[model samples]
Target: MAEHPAYPVGLRLTGRRVVVLGGGQVAQRRLPALIAAGADVLLVSPEATPSVEAMADAGEITWARRRYADGDLADAWYALIATSDPEANAAASAEAERHRVWCVRSDDADAATAWTPATGHSEGVTIAVLTTHAKGRDPRHTAAVRDAVVEGLRDGTLVAPHHRTRTPGVALVGGGPGDPDLITVRGRRLLAEADVVIADRLGPRDLLAELPPHVEVIDAAKIPYGRYMAQEAINNALIEHAKQGKSVVRLKGGDPYVFGRGMEELQALAEAGIPCTVVPGVSSSVSVPGAAGIPVTHRGVAHEFTVVSGHVAPDDERSLVDWPALARLTGTLVILMGVDKIGKIAETLVAHGKSPDTPVALVQEGTTAAQRRVDATLATVAEAVRTHEVRPPAVIVVGEVVTVGPREPE
Candidate 1:
């Protein structure tokens, strides 16, 4: 007997009754997607995985807290027979057959009426791949194919230029702590669709090389106290490209809001009536220290962590940070863009009653191959930076938390 090819169709399970006959790993994995589709799921099981229990507790699903019984599939538009008991699974399958409800069996796929596909979503498109023939069923192969297609679409390798509609706007994407892989999925997707990308030198630089040659890459690197692009110029570039119906991406380092001047760019776009999207990134404040095996806050070590910009000297009239108050707090302090002014900042902290022997760590180019950690104290950090030639774009950690992690190679 030859198995015929299965017809593929998306089930609109919204507000529909769905009966699941297991609360184990299989149900835990499948329940979220079902719930997301607005399915009124009822699970019949003696016990469930902690995650499944959490879902039930959250009122996302109805849990029977018992084994499957007859008439469980009476009004179910769909059913999943995945109970540990083979007899229970067989009975549920038979009930589903009698009721003409499509059911998927985790144990015996051949006996099931439905097959779940390897699914993924990119942009606004849902990708689903299923092996149709019973003899040729290969879940791993189907998943691999799905992943390849999804990755291609996400990285802009698979182009549907003619069929795809272009939206002209600016996307402020956070590239995330200098790691190319750390960028958010939404940020990466927007980059794939970008016509003009204004990039920073501090973030995921490797991704720039992966962009198609057609994309105009503009260097908007704001090198600290060095050669850099002006903020006004960057704002103008974003406006100009967007006004020309180009999808412009302002790719920045770390979170756009976390000292990235993202609001300035947004304000400029708003003034010009250009639509903008801001995708948050992993901030270097916490991630950089973590990358160096240092936790920003540790139990019984530091109760609070503060992130401050050190671009301005504490004595400068334009400085907004209250150095004296920060010094008084017995917690971790993370300073960014403070390499040049670290000596002055450290002096101010010590003068304000902070211990001069407070442990300090300078994580330069954090989360990248060029990353290096320099250890010191408030008294020695100024010298450590000078001796080590530690540059800007580094995160400086001050307090006992810096001593909590494994020692960096001397």
Candidate 2:
């Protein structure tokens, strides 16, 4: 018989009976999709894998605990014949034919009435790929094609500009801690859909280069004690763009709520009667330290980790941090934006009873190619910072947990 192209069609199996003739790896892989489609799945096998048995125990599917019988496909809308026994598989496939049910045979696709394509979904789009040749069918080729399409859709490389749904609002997207790939999927998608982007200096800078020419990239960088953009001005720009019915993305570094001033922007938009969407990103307080091979908390080493902003010195009147209380806690302390004030911070912690010998690590430009770690003690960290010419935007980790992981990169 000559091989022919398979006509692909989606099966709406909701509330439909799907009889699976095996409880092995093949059935384990396919059962989830069937269950997700709301299919009433029935498993017919004398023995089953642990995963398949768990599914039956959970009532996700019915298990007969027996071999494939003649009447097993009596009223099944779809059948999957995947038993280890070839004779049993053939019998089940033949029974499905008599019942006029669509059947898929795992052992012999050419003999089955249907074939499952390599399927994937992204951004509300389903990608299914089927590769057929006169010689044979290549499952790997089908999966590769499906993966490519799904990835392109997810990253907006395959987006149709004309088909885009223009949502006119301000999105406070966390671009994650320094790394462009660390940004959330929704954040990246929102950025691709943005007409106006107000970005910070600390956020993922590499992603900005990927934006289309039409996107207006605004520099809202708040450089430390240097040339900077005011928060009020950034808020006004977000409001102004959103009022013009444009999609605005306020791309910030790290988690928006984690000392990112995300709520301030959200509140400003709310007062201006503009809608806002907030997409959270991985916080640098933990991720940066982890990138430098330091765990903020370790068993029997540090029981708790505290994240604090060190933009202000402990003696400064504007500082709200309780230095005395923080020093008394037997845990880890992670400070952000405190490189310049490290001298005063170290003095305050040591004076407040924290040991001068407490280990400290400064991770600069963490998770990026420029990442470097500088180690010191509470008494020596201030000098270490000055000696190394360490700059702001570095995460300062204090306490014993700093010494719990692999040695800092040279």
Using TM-score, give the best candidate's number: 2
Estimate, for each residue in 1-410, the C-alpha lDDT of model 2 and write its tens digit. Answer: 22667788999999999999989999999999999999999999988999999999999999999999899999999999999999999989989999899999999987888889999998666889976542578898889999888877776666646465566899999989999989987888888888999998898999999999999998886423234257777888889899998999999999999999999999999999999999999999999999999999888998999999999999999999999999999999999999999999999999999999999999999999999999999999999999998987899999998888888657
lDDT of 1: 0.91
C-alpha lDDT (0 to 100) for residue 228 of candidate 2? 29
Candidate 2: how many backbone clashes? 0
C-alpha lDDT score of every prediction, in listed order: 0.91, 0.90
- C-alpha displacement of 242 in model 1, angstroms? 0.5
The sequence of per-residue lDDT tens digits that candidate 1 reaches over residues 1-410 is: 22697778999999999999989999998999999999999999999999999999999999999988899899999998888899999999999999999999999888889999999987778999998787878899999999998887775567546356767899999999998888887788778778999998776889898888899998885423234358877888889889999999999999999999999999999999999999999999999999999999999999999999999999999999999999999999999999999999999999999999999999999999889999999999999999999998899999999989797786
What range of 10 consecutive residues in model 2 has the weakest lDDT sum?
A: 221-230
Candidate 2 is scored at a TM of: 0.93
